[model samples]
Target: MPGIEAGGIAVVLVARSAIAAAPRAEMERLAGQVSGLHEIALATYAFTEQGQPALREVVANLRRRPFREIRLVPLLFPMEASFRAWIGRTLARWQLEWDTEGPAIRIGPGPNASERLTDLVSDLVETAGREKPFMPAEHPATTGSVVAAAHRRVLVCQGGPCNEAGAAAIWGHLRNEQEGQSLRTAGSGMMSATTSCLGPCSLAPVVQVWPEGTVYGGVNEAGIDAIIREHLLGDRPVESLAYPANGRKQALRLRE
Candidate 1:
């Protein structure tokens, strides 16, 4: 409560994953040493799984604290497009849900990891004596061949919204469907991977396809089969299930 002056600033560090607890702790410890501040508090939040104190939770905690202004600093390096979008939406949601008169919230740019992180990597490499090469004895060349042969690549959003919308089941179904396909030839290939939040929180269980960048929303177990057959194999976008590129909300017709 000592730091709750009318002009005091509170710093919030946003991490990429749950594993950044140690770094967050270290940041908080360092923040304490700074002088000439009305009040200063450091909090950390993660975007994806494997981290505790999620962004929502941290924001909620901050609301109860005494602060005139809040500054959010992303702990990511070279900030990905998806991350930027997610953060923007999250801040907007917070503004709508809470009283804005208490604290003025502002988001700062992500840490540029190009120079500093590279230097740190170099230091670590030097500390650990350079051996022959960082490689195993046997390398499977077939793995590359398999990946290269895939014609269609599907990215399933495994971020917070999708997870809450039962994305685990959708992911499991996608994997099962991929495995069932006959990959006897090079052209007949399909690959699926999971990614963080795709920025469309309202459209949970979102699936994106490349190179078309077609996104489908409200995907479920029943729709998985159609997606595989029509979109993946048949080379057609599922128009009915597609999410708009302009990020507008639309009526989702997911099967029961």
Candidate 2:
């Protein structure tokens, strides 16, 4: 697509939850160097769950801004069917909610698993490796600092359906548990992150424990404690809440 006029158009990079932060920062930095675009923003959403600044949220925020044309670029590797459906639904909702005088909306294709994207990821990894080492938090002694890589990463889905299904509460509980466990203490070896979606909306409010790749569905506040105690702390997944890998639906167990 052609570059937009200086003050009339905005470009929003819609990214997946996993690698969104760093790439969004990089894209914003690059977009700032380009002349003509009114504003460059980042909106992250999940295919099956509720992510922050979802498309609807992004549109609402953009309408409050000064731009007349809003361009949405999906940072997906492949524009899958679910992605198309979600984007179409989101735009339709926007059209229904806003007037014609609102900012014109446009959707751009994803990166499509291109070699360029692969190269970019490679470069990012190499660059990060060469950069300064990570310091988890401020500390007096350097030897006691916790490194994120050494921790077991827990990703909680905060996508739309999940959010509607009370994923926010579940996330809060998880965060509280994470802090309560003192996982960030020197050798505790546990960390948690909030993700946009995990691609299973029917099983909303999901939590995935990485390295183990165990996904728990329909998680609630009560389940959060079990997840932390059994999985994060004990290294044994709570199979009762675990999402089956074979695509079979288990009975919903978490409290609403």
Candidate 3:
């Protein structure tokens, strides 16, 4: 942690999915050396299907700490302009939504891809000419194209208003919970996917269980708890959140 500024400044590097989920190694070292921020960590712009780390979650944790200011440094570059705008907007929304005020949050300028990575890419090309590339796997590209053998499918809406409503985090959490509870493809046979819409936009953000077509409205991270324990992990659906109040199918239908 040498060369890092000593005060209570937290530097968040917005890295790719894996690194953002668990910050480590050269990235952490570089942040300490170059920026000299008091504390350097990693976070992603948004959550993923695999339920990676989220910027919101990262910042919220930092706010609870003694840090005076939190700096977000996005390592991802060459992304859509709208996505970048979404990042700024999401942070703004978080500040407004969260009741308590903590440390001031700031977004650091992202790395300039051309200026920063031109040499790196050039060297990689030069090195690749001499060094052999990684060998391809023996399995065909279509090896994973088959459908999963699952009993249930959970659809977490991500597109449209759902995205603005923080559906990404919810999606991540649902998938994370499924795995954490051992309700995976081979186990309890629960499969999750990101969907465009599940109707009932007035419900704003919603979660749907397939086959039975059970849609739960007004869902947040807390709501997922009941849905998991009741509908997903249990025989009964969460009665309180049943969107239409009587929309659930009698039993879960599974396919082998």
Candidate 4:
């Protein structure tokens, strides 16, 4: 007997705009721009009990349906303590469950304002204000009398766990995206490189960029693109995507 499918694909996008008051509209807009099977934003429920169940139900429903793919994109800022411990734990559980169920669990890349996202933010910065402010004498990316221009170098972690989790593929995409292009010209990228051992084993598949020491975990090709286009190219930082030095949760600064 031929069977009818109930849903296309289930994607549970858990966001933390409420707790951190970080930018959510921009993320929703970007997700709309990217092509995907399905998307659901858990803005309000994200902090509540209902949210977890909603997430589980999505995964369960997806598992029941004969689909080859299921994706979960955490839209929270990376450094938020709750997101780090609480949310990460929840997602980890779901991931394990998915593994047992045996479906291709493709976790969407983000934490927003990622390296690729910087590209878009730089453009926005250029358009802001009547007159362009003089670039900082010591921009984070520059050094010496020239004053560091803060070129936004992307440092992807190619460590053991990260590579196994597909960091190499994302690194390739990040490199390919920035090849032959100048951050000054495209207004993005002073430099981009893939590195070894960013240290946070729990947060494998990481990429960090300069000026603010912004770090992005759970990243992939599209995530890298978002960082390049939004945060690197545009003036705004992807406040949501960063993993801070301290484990404590604090308000995210848009710029260093």
Candidate 1 lDDT? 0.65
- Model 2 clashing residue pairs (backbone): 49-159, 49-160, 50-158, 50-159, 50-160, 51-159
Answer with 2 or 3, whichever has the higher TM-score: 3
Question: Candidate 2 residues 1-256, lDDT tens each?
Answer: 3243334666666654323476546655654554343354322232122234344556666667656677777766656645655555546644664654566778776776465888888899999999997777665665665446545778888787766665654665565555555765434377778888888778777889888888888775567788877777777899888877776655556442
Q: Which residue pairs in candidate 3 collide?
A: none
* Best of the candidates, TM-score: 3
**After superposing candidate 1, which stretches have Cα over 4 Å from the reference?**
1-6, 19-50, 113-256
Question: TM-score for all predictions?
Answer: 0.46, 0.41, 0.68, 0.38
Q: List the residue pairs that clash in candidate 1.
A: 18-50, 18-51
On lDDT, the candidate that comes out on top is 1
Which of the predicted structures, 1 or 2, would earn the higher TM-score when compared with the native? 1
Model 4: how far is 239 from its true place, Å?
2.8
Candidate 3 TM-score over all chains jointly: 0.68
RMSD of 4: 18.6
lDDT of 4: 0.55
lDDT of 4 by residue, 133-208 (tens): 6776564764556543555666888787676665644555555556534453477446766678987756667888
- How big is the positional error of residue 50 in model 4, measured in Å on the Cα after superposition? 43
